[model samples]
Target chain A: MSEIRRRDPRREWIARNRLHRDHVSVLAVLGQGNTPSEWLGPNGVMRRNPHAVGFIGPNGLKRIDRSGGQQGGPATVATGTAASDSRQAVTIEAPAFLVAVVPDMSGGRLSSHDRDLLGLARQLADADPARPGAVLAVLFGSHKEEALGEAGVDRLLHLGDDAYEGYAPEARLAVLAAVERDLAPRHWLLPDSPLGGADLGRRLAARLGERPATGVWQLEADAEARGKNGSGWRCTARGAANTRDFLRPLPRVALALAECAEPVSETRHAAEPVTLAQPLPVLLSRIADLGPVAVDPAGVALAEAGFILSAGNGVTDWEGFHHAAKLLGATQGASRVAVDDGHMPRHRQVGATGTWVTARVYVAVGISGAIQHLQGIQSCDKVVAINRDPGCDMIKRADLAVIGDAALVLQALVTLVEQEREEKRHAA
Target chain B: MRPDPQKSPSLAITVLVSVGCHPLTGRGRRADQDARGVELARALPLAEVRLLHAGVLDAGSDAALRGYLGMGFDALTLIEQPESSDVVPALAEVLADHPPTLVIAGTRAERGEASGLLPYLLAERLGWPLVAAVAEVEGVEGGVATLLQALPRGQRRRLQVRLPAILTVDSAAPAPRQSAFGPARRGQLAVHEVGEAVPDAELVEWVEQPARKRPKRLKIVKAASARDRFKAAAAKAEGGSGQVLDGVTPEQGAEAILKLLKEEGVLRR
Candidate 1:
């Protein structure tokens, strides 16, 4: 039988490799040498650099011994280091800056950073010109082409494995640690949307004992502003505080009240031409030197009506999911429950680690108001929460809280809305 | 009903609320938002209920969590996966040594890595039948335990699982019980350390944490008259005044509206 000739997905990879001929050094941790098209653009450009390298434990990898070599054969065994060129890990010098096209899940689709993420990336790129920039992105099985087209990226990394998707907290963190140790970029850039990326950044920052910031609309630095230690960089950014409420406020207090809301505007999506004078640094683990990932060349997934009837943990059962759906003419969404049950995709998650959405209305049912979850939906114009516990964190954050079971509250609300619609029909 | 000896033998049920987002680089979850898996975990009738806050822990938050841990469980276990967003390893650690007959968590974390992948992952890893979105877990009987599962459209289903199985309790399970101040204050938290070290990343600048927003109030309290009865009557009558102009030209209707507004002192002539 003739062996089937498999087409090399790396043909475009080789063409894309032509651009990186000038790059003298490249570092990849956990390099799998997988098909390049999955991680790169159709033309072979890399996208979604989601892996980094850090010091992993000694036993992190499987040990290999020489099979049946003679006395003088290659050393019987070799110790692998996190930075070793082994398939499991590798090490290299830190790049000038780390550029990640941080995944934004707002509107249930992949999006680029508003002015904030770009500003930070540009500022960091300008900070040091010698080292490469590392671009990291999260791909939700779709958006492969769009991710590769994101502006200001060098190498693209992909961190999607069937098992990794099912990762628990420890396995998830391990991958991050590995990514950190491999690509030691000076400056790390991420989008402000919820998804584990920015939180990982914060945790990574805390682990490294560095200060972190949020809601940074823009970033700037004086060329002369040096780090206190004279070895790092200094930068500043514009931050915002938005408030969300279900009720339209008295004009006087509305502005003050507005401080708690999440930003309602989603990231703009366009296939506009972006000029790249020079390649930005993109370092990722597993794949070597995949370059210049793009922003959502593909549009994101969003609801047309600009409304979300979101359920939180407060929703004790599917009954709540049903009730909330009826009251607002909303599509049923779970706070990971729907996704975990295989009803929805992880891309639809709304929280710090999932997608960030600011619809006109976000009705949170059975959800406790946590700061992280608030970060995702606070931009919505109005928010309502229902729970038996009036003091659940969500109650204080909600525009209105009906103190009852989510099911009961949703049923009552559905009836009220239905009656209103019926009366309007009759009057008409 | 008599309890089945094999079903309840040395079996301990524990609920683990998965908090924190799935780790993707670039964005963070909201500060005030979460899936409230903690409440779901508390609702389960188990030997212990643990809320795992895997998101970025701001400064001075340990005491707050410790306070909550003191409420009532045998121990409040803190699973720390420093600087990493992957939760599978932590779940692996827990199930490896202390495999509970039943394990429950939110579908996803509140902040990073909000993939809602833990329950499936745990079930697959443990090779257990995962009853997701479970509403109620009846006691062990005849070597099997019955669980009320929440189906779509507010429906429910019952399933019986053998002992030593994993079940993911969803928000559709039942109303999570309220945490009383007393139990919350007295519960003892036994902090368990996972063996992963956080890496050192560069620090740029500290952005001042923004304040969370509160709900808003109404702009106008429209009352036509001072008396409550009069106000109610006026409100009822306000919607009845518009006259239908079925055959009248739009121009004529506009002119009539303009004249009425002028007479009422609403518009200038």
Candidate 2:
């Protein structure tokens, strides 16, 4: 076999080096020498370094051992004068816990966001092999204790009261700030739910004077090896085109997105219930519960919907499109063209510049699946595209492609659904 | 609670404007932050609103800065600083010299080192209470302002914060009116010089790679039974199989979809 010549500069560089390209890129970008320094203390391990800045990497802070030998397994906290010096600056109360501020699940069930936070807490606890911390679930309202225990929460701090019924950011902030002051946890984790998590996280961070990484999807912590300076957390946030990783010292707060971390299996941990010493301070007085306002059924927010029936330019029969959506109990969504053409309201538009949806099932009716439109539905689990053109991007990306007139397909589906429901009722 | 009309005279609103860069195109445009910030400031009836921008003026940024000017503002105070310099210290200095009753800004700039850390860092520097995601300013009275904060899913919360606080506007804030060309052409861009230049700590190497489609996230399955677990694993491994359904009747296609939906558990019988 003849050796093939590569044209691309990046590929050629990788081929010449024969080393991990990411590691080489980090060294080249930071202008660091390629002498593998055994920098971690005995038992300390360097996971992976993407881009290096001084001691910081994509993973975490790296300690450079000038002695030059990769003899250590994973860096463990070495007892020495340097460690003592690092510890002298800050005093930490032992038995540090990973606290997750979780909201009351609407129906007493754990949301995926809740699960991600629990998983994050577990990871943070496991990071510190020396003194494995406990995962604390701070519940704003009453929840199923069994679910919390099964989610691997070691402790449950329940703040159940009539006043804490609905989502109140101010009240939650007061309680969380007080909890932080009382418990003094090493890490405070929150899901980046706009309902309250993002707001609460930012407010708590501001209150505690800690810089937080919001909408973080990946995070790693070194809680066990608390040098004089204490441990630090490395958070990775995904942007449109790039990924940005932030490294902040321990006693920090972060808001992780719902789907960021892989949730671990439910563990049966003995849940120890605790209460706040002081009552939650009343920051604001509620004037009245106005109840839910009436909104147009056709104009539903795309982001919150579990199932969406989206219409595009190809959708001419608005009545059929809406009827199908109603019959299937799916929220109506429109592409930019549909909204621009006044077929649907502006709020119903879903794309890059419009609402982003993470629905369980997204049915595209007549949507050509433009890049922007696809971007909006990227998080959708199962996509069923109905398009006239067989070669359209929508058909290629969909889990199920129905090559037919969108109106006919939608009408048929709606009729079939209605008939099935009627038959089931009669059979019962 | 309603804000008192009598105390409106003492209110002074300062809106901070920054260059918003488009992430994908890298084009300098009127930032969504400044647009919302400007609109929020304009909404206040009795308060005197001043527009401020911090950075050395360039052709790309001047155009974006003028966007605020186009929205009926006469002049924008540009605190001259290098693009690479940290604007926090300079911003704090200017803010200290001419302290306003309330400071409003966008949550974060869109382009170039969009850390979303400015509001938090600025609040820390000024030692002021920071309020995020403000949808509307309900009222300001007696050194306190009533704000309707935006929550996820169109819910709003009424919050009262003491004056001399910093607020970052969310997208839920009323959409800004289109900028008039005549006013934008006539608006003044006043520049102020600062003493020091803070060196930029370019920690993360930002390589502009072509945007790639995001990989599908693994669905978290919590099945207890072995059969259920096996089914879930198989579904994930297969990545979903589908038929093209070419030349098929609408009835047949609907049936196929219904079967798939039932298999995926998206629909109930």
Candidate 3:
């Protein structure tokens, strides 16, 4: 008897500890049939069985056998029905387009989050071949057209006015309402900025009488499906308790979350400049610009940082925390206990009630992970936890756990990093 | 520096409280928004405040409802409705009959179907301007109220909106004061029967399963080595083979960490 040996490339890939671009796609390739499959769970445990197949669930990857079939049946049924309904109900008249609302910063600069939205817009446009969509950017302040064009934007709708100087929600809403009417886009993408993106997105959704999906991290359009409603877009978002995937018809608005897509640098096409002819509604309220107040660089605003070193109640050495943060050039964060005990400021607290961070790497020291603290760092790419308790929440959720005192571990890390820097300096 | 009391009429504030429970524990308590709403009402001078709840009156909900009354309130209006009935229509009907200068609520409820959609839908139904994530009510003169809207990253925006508006309090609002036991036990739960009870259509079939942890970010390793394999195996273990520096000196522990850091490529030397 001949045996069909289909060796999964991911098994070897996982063994190497190399970075995979998309885990969901990997699961799709592996979890095809009744063949025995091996996969790593979110807790880093590997399970292998004949009945189990690698599946991408809301909470990440799971080895689902036939026994787990009943539990997942309802969620799939719900999404399928909704997708079919939305596809049939909405009719597309104008050319399919993905309009992104670009956020303008204090200076004549575009935020990384906004740039990511442009990249995503371009990706969505390229997905459909029948009527390849166009990507448009609604710019607020003055910006270089070349820079925006390079970030994969096909066209620029520049709104350079004195009213667009700061985070003016009302003025922005009026401008978006006018743009929506003029373009009548199939999908409206807004970057989930702390300044004004969320508010503007919700307000525009209400005005258009459309239900919006917020905190959307992943979106894909089903282009090859049958029926008019079958080819709608599917949006994945992180809800309060669980992650959810839903299908929405055309003319839907979504608030794009951070760290979902990388910004593209190469310009794919020439970006045409456009303008608005209609007058905007009068602003209801005026903002008083307070000059920039200086803040500590290593403070609690670590939401956008690529590297973060956070301390918990287990950390006793404040000096070590500061030293480690400086050595790694990472932002500083603290668990609720550390903030409550006066070891750190209230602004530096990371938890359910505090700031939600999406960093490339998060290093937790001396912090026993409370559920709230774990919730805040859900989007972190790599979590390296150093704690005394092996059974703590932080350790369980971390990709790497080093059992030791936080101060000692941080001190050692700082020392090694400093030595490396000094050796490089001498070589130079 | 106070405004003339005779010129400005006292503002009428109405607060909507919902049954609060711990999302994980399911244990009932006073909702966070209700407490903050009550506290905000207490801070306003020349304000007539009333507390209202629209839900079924049951033994399970009594404890949480009483918890709100414990905040020194003499009575709370409970609009009787079934568990499956829609509360928005009932609340809107009652508010229309007894219009107030301002309506306040928490950003969202903590219990079942906590969609955070009530405030937005209600505002649209009532044709009232909605202000969300308000930290404080700076002042109210004539018909305009100045509000301090809470933004992320420790930033605040001030805006003025016309009165007869709805405001949702964010976590930045002042914490509620302690609830007195005696006042809570003695407080009245007044029942009001108004509006039609419309049953909500249950669209999605809910299946119960043990909560699962979020999926780990997929890491693809390109380096192929015996040391890399060992490191990967160690990282994937449930009760990881982490070196516990129990009884070791801080210097020894530091050295072990330095070795690990270098092996992990977190530090280059």
Candidate 4:
């Protein structure tokens, strides 16, 4: 009953050759889909043939992926989804110039903002393929990201010293200044984020006496350009607190916003380790960092909160809701109805008119999901709705919707969390 | 508005304010972060808070400058400068003339280029330390001020910046007090004619435009294989693919929420 089907090398060669009379039948028997991309015609005129199977790209373009991602139809599609090793390895040896990028590296990962900045750097570096530049990433402290090469970094300058951690903008500024003096990079790109780059970028700009373009979100290769190095480029930056956009020529230094450019998706770089040619200058910093302060989640600002426990009109048991928020270490937020009913302060309201929160996880208990409320939380990664009404808008929007009494659910969650903590404590 | 020298402490705080434009109506108002900086300075005990601005006091910005005055200030020192001129030198000169123990400013302006570099340049020129994204001033001891710096995701860092240092307020700082119409109408803009203005050549050359709406990043199934795409599509559609559990008991609901919380790495335990 058991049979080992072995490979037929001669038949495979004939099917692949495409010149044999029995090629068609051999391919059919081998279950290998036909239609070669190109073959010599009968008269020796070459012909280009389109594949019968092709996938539509993200932009709705019919793209035939020759990386062996798609073939043999859906039946054999599950065989391999090797999208990992498809990146084209690119190395720019003796780059004409350098485009330096300083990523935030928050939580020791290349954040979306950092990736976008790298993408922008890639644009500048890859502008002229004949005289291509290299992207030099300036990393501070330590990082856990393993895909620095895939993130479009050509050169890596890591400062793993303990003195560069915490709020050491002064020391970080000194490193950037040294980089500027030694490498003389063509362009300096940094995320216009408050975490660290925004502070350090401004200091570097001041020290270099380069009027950097801050709050930059969009960039265009200009027709008529003028600059010392970053010429032929223009940028659009948000100004007046995002009320207007300032279109200006791209300068030597640029502090860009998140999503300024699409991250490098198709290529991998060397990410070769580099070093400062000179030693870092010791600074007599007047600001002394005392490390991080432990802040209660409840005291966290709504816009800055990573996880939010938000309540709504249906939240009857206010005491249980507050208890759950405190126990879960989640920031407290309220819907407009809850705020208007005086159950919560207006500042805590979550809606279009209220703070447009970018929390990673938004837990909406008893929220009906008003249009404005949904709009305000549009940027949140996950929405958890706990409501009795399954047909509510919040339930539809939630990644996980729990239909039940808000009070009872809160009580059960609190009890479950307490039990988990108690078990962990006992195990320790 | 000077307090009696014998009664008041010698702590001087100056908040640099800028005119803000409403995103929808384009109306002028007090810049959000500057107002927060002013609020932070005012919340500090026994500190003399002064509002400073360096831009043309036109009708549009006059109302905006007065908005800061409405926050219980008698006057705002407005150093007259042209539209395309660099204001850092003027603001730096004022700070150097009467160096304050602490200078507060917004992360960035709401008008013009709004590079958010004024404070750094001022600090560099004055040779003083500069702290960015400060949430609150805990207290001042001797000549150093202990400040709470706001980090991403609601975390904070404690720092001690020496006297005559500049601080830039983060958006996470405590909200500003509402401006009063009565004070806004009565408050005078103490306009000062400064020295010759140096036109910002780069700013004058570039064009200005309305903010363009960025395209939303679509969650495209970037699968390399047809099988992978088919599997991804079958697993979940764009929207309306969420799981809704009905007729579940409170304990069951709690279990589902806990599972999701754990999956998202939000549950600490």
DockQ of each two-chain model: 0.01, 0.12, 0.06, 0.45
Cα RMSD (angstroms) for every candidate in the order listed: 28.6, 19.4, 17.0, 8.3
lDDT of 4 by residue, A52-116 (tens): 54756678878765546454455235444334556789999999999999999976778889999
Poorest 10 consecutive residues of model 2 chain A by lDDT?
A: A68-77
Q: What order do you get sorting by DockQ, best first?
A: 4, 2, 3, 1
Clashing pairs in 3: A17-B221, A18-B220, A18-B221, A18-B222, A19-B220, A20-B220, A59-B215, A60-B215, A87-A229, A88-A229
* Candidate 3: tens digits of C-alpha lDDT, residues A270-385: 46776766777776643333323322346535776555778888888898788778766567888998888998888777778888987656778888887788889887756778
Tell me the spans in candidate 3 whose CA falls farther than 4 Å from its real position: A1-95, A100-112, A142-146, A192-195, A220-231, A240-251, A260-269, A283-428, B1-8, B55-60, B80-87, B112-115, B197-269
Model 1 chain B poorest ten-residue lDDT run: B260-269
The best candidate by TM-score is 4
- Best-to-worst ranking by lDDT: 4, 2, 3, 1
Pick the winner on TM-score between candidates 1 and 4: 4
Model 4: CA > 4 A from native = A1-84, A226-230, A294-296, A299-304, A308-325, A332-428, B178-188, B218-269
* Candidate 4 positional error at B120, Å: 1.5
Quote the TM-score that chain A achieves in each candidate.
0.34, 0.49, 0.45, 0.67
For candidate 1, the per-residue lDDT at A168 reads 21
Give the alpha carbon lDDT tens digit for every residue of B151-219 in model 1.
322334556666566555554544443445665556654556776743423211232333334235332
Q: Give one digit per residue, the lDDT tens place, for model 4 in B10-77.
A: 58999999888776777898889999999998888777888999888789999888889888998889
Model 3 residue B126 CA deviation in Å? 3.8
TM-score of chain B of 2: 0.77
> How much lDDT does candidate 3 score?
0.68
